[model samples]
Target: MSPYYVSYKSDGTLVSGPGSITAIGNQTGASSYNNRTSGYLWCPTARDFTVGSGGNKGTTADLATRTASICYMRGLKERVEIQTSSGAPWQWRRICFRFRGNIYGASGQNSQSGNYQTHIETSNGYRRLLLQFTDTSPAGNQVENALTALIFRGLPGTDDWYDYMNAPLDPTRIDVCYDKTSTISSGNTSGKVFRKNFWMPMNKNLVYDDDEAGGTESSTYYSMHGKQGMGDYYVIDFFKAGLGTTSSDVLVFEPQSTLYWHEK
Candidate 1:
């Protein structure tokens, strides 16, 4: 039997239910919906990004499972540390999400903010998923010690027309990097940039390097990969081992593939 589909009207009212709708048509003029509640499903608590922490810090382990109804990361105090494996020591990195949506951030009018969210239209027809960070310590710090969050809104299961079956599964395939030539930079200098020409499959366990090792070219960088047909939410913990540092300025890039999985 075909799965039940639900959606909402533009007026914030529930339009369809389990038995009220069948297949959606062009004239439906309704948003897609999944009958799942919003909350943390995998990681009940925030995973540590520090090395050897035994939590979800790297791409090897599946952090995507802990994704809340909206996936996010929070740093309680100024001492909280997070880093990507490829980042320099004692440097701040930015966290980035690779999904397609109208990007929004809590930091400022720009995209680089301690707290942010993304509204990805799933391959399915539903548009009700919300990924948000509820609590952030040091309420007014904003700069020195700020909390970062990433929210994803989409269908839950893989049965939708554009489910995980066609989405890029490799996490490393989505490259997040620093744009500035120097290691010690501040502000948008460390914003997220995309390298679309350099695309690789994230369906592996080990780190994949597209270019030769130690090459003096942009193509020599390496990335962590993810698995195909996996969960919808993917989380990456950032950690740093220096004092007075926050790794929150990292870029996330994904190769443009012909895979028609992002839209349903």
Candidate 2:
């Protein structure tokens, strides 16, 4: 049994399965035009997301900054056609990453914090996906910023799972961890501390750890097999919120895929 499950509807009653609904386009709200054309939607507001800045330290108030990171795990079975506004069709899949952790920067010395962030390739082939993290202080002199560890496939539209595999030593358990520490001080005053940890799962059997230096690393192969199953269609797992510490939070994105017309 998969540790994660995909559910539709607000009640979490419409559990998805192998031979479930495959078509997209449906009414998501009472308003006629409010119909949802996306194949699926999963919003994980229940989980707290955070991003780390760097290491832990302080004095001049410019210690380390706070940044947000994302971790994603996906199980795919088939391939779906990704269409663009120019009427271009390409093969693609949706990989969702669920995040849970603290948003605000850690306090005091020797403190740590972390969050999870996920990404996927749109039909258009644009690789960079911009995500927002929380603001430090509205009226403070502290320097703050956000960071994330991105894992992806280098060879786009390829079908080899081994290249993208992060084979975990243990076949039964797979774990990913990211930690950041911040230190701040003037020209020899004192130092403060800030730190954070973020983690998620890559299937046990499909685990592959390339152990590259930077976070913006991409795998050369696919982690899971691409067979004819439920994985071939559009899939929505959960929705993640930004790291804004206040109500002025906003999640922005430019739609990359062209909308398709489905005959109900």
Candidate 3:
């Protein structure tokens, strides 16, 4: 069986698939990804479930996941070449993800430290990766406080929300190879060919948080805003928080994760 990670509900029920890339499953009170094959993902678009611990879609939302057993992708850095004869062609696109280690879930309470982000800056003589959002600022590096914070509703704020600037596990960094062709003898150019490379460390457990507005601080509902912090965009203390404090404590068990993709 393919190695994988598994997430659970606060009740300790099966949440994500550690063996199969099922569809994003749903939890009544938390931000857990429901492992169904077809349906509305937590992010609102059609969920793109897969077989292994990875999916092919590039959009955020349920597309990203975490489990204690995130090692499914350990030692895997191969470029996910856009399949030429993929039965699902439209699913091909630029994508990237990374796995974190020793980390735990985040809490909305006191979320502002031990975090890091970087981007590329253009105005500088040499292009280099800086903090996230800033990587594209100055024509490259940027401080995307906007992206730093996210009030993710079921459908871009259409339904109840699980988080509001609750630091969800974000990629430490992302790199993309866009508008290219796949590496194959019979090159298929019907769609765009892109590749995303990710780097992850097994040391730091990038903990994220959610401060539920309803005062229901269930582990299952971790980082979720309960529906009160709606329409309010938080200025994510970008490049912040993860001090291993009482609140920033990473989960004791393994944090599960999957290399998700959109396969349409």
How many residue pairs clash in each candidate at the backbone level?
A: 27, 52, 60
Q: How much does candidate 2 score in TM-score?
A: 0.18
Tens-digit lDDT track of model 3 for 1-264: 233322211111222221111111221111112211111111100111222223332222332333221112232122222222221122111122221111112432222222221211122111111111222122221122223222121322325432222323333321111112222212242323344443322221222232234754212111222222111111111111112112211111111222222211
Residue 110 CA displacement from its true place in model 1, Å? 26
Q: Rate the local accuracy (lDDT) of all candidates.
A: 0.22, 0.21, 0.21
lDDT of 2 by residue, 107-203 (tens): 3111111112222222221121222121222123121121111223222123522211121122121122321221112212222121222122223
Cα RMSD, model 3? 21.2
Candidate 1 structure quality by residue, lDDT tens digits, 128-235: 212323212224433212222223223323343232112222333333321111132223324322221211122212222223336431121112123322222222
Which runs in model 3 stand beyond 4 Å of their true positions? 1-4, 7-83, 86-202, 210-217, 220-264
Best by lDDT: 1
